[model samples]
Target: MRDLYQRLRITPEAEAAEIAAAIERCQHTALKADAATVLQAEWRRAEYDALHDTLSDIGRLRARLGLTHAPYWRAGPADDFSLPPGPPGSRFEEWMQRLNRAARAHNRWRRLRLGWWLATLWLATLAGGVALGHFVLP
Candidate 1:
């Protein structure tokens, strides 16, 4: 996948006007056309951004793991590696769903834990105030 942001010499956070300006100033016709096609529309741009981020993360992970050749598998003899020729099927979708569920569950747990801590702090403050009032007034 091409990094449109890098191609256009702009940051990922560039605004629509900035992208349009970059497209206008771009000298390469092919790069200009590609950038205009992908970055002009909101939906396409969003999908591109998501895919780009995912690919970039995968690349970083591969580099970190010293497996720059293949993904999710160790780098071995060239003949030992073979990728599926077709698009991912139901199993991929199911795995993504499971991951999403796990993320949501973890977020919910974090919020609940924060709420408990705040409640405990509030109770402690209230108890301290009551005790201070009882002793100081008498």
Candidate 2:
């Protein structure tokens, strides 16, 4: 996703007036109109910010996982090309193995963290229900 704030040359936290000023100063009339339309509304700006943040997070995750190449759909079949045979103890192979191991470890940690949060949320909901039953039912 395009970074609207960067395009407009304004910070994400910029006020409406600041955004309007930046939009007016934009050289491209189409971009200026688009920015004004999106940024002029409170709710649209909030939605754009959320979408931008999520896309940025995904980008960071991809970089961390060494997935800087085009996505799977853009990349051709896996069997299209094969790696050249290397020595038994090649440094590249060793580095790749280590990277795979680290990626697996990171994935496991993320799953564990997500599970913990889900469990906590479930418990909180259960406790709230019990409290409501105890106090409001009687």
lDDT of 2 by residue, 36-84 (tens): 8789998999898888777766655544444444446333332122223
What TM-score would every model get versus the actual structure? 0.47, 0.49
- Candidate 2 whole-model C-alpha lDDT, 0 to 1: 0.74
Best by TM-score: 2
| CA lDDT, every model vs. true structure | 0.75, 0.74
Off by over 4 Å in 1: 67-138
* Residue 81 in model 2: lDDT: 21
Q: What TM-score does candidate 2 get on C-alpha atoms? A: 0.49
Regions more than 4 Å wrong, model 2 = 69-95, 98-138
Give per-residue CA lDDT, model 1, range 1-138, as digits (tens). Answer: 567787678987999999999999999898789889999999999999997787766655544433434454434323122223224444455566899999999999999999999999999999999999999998
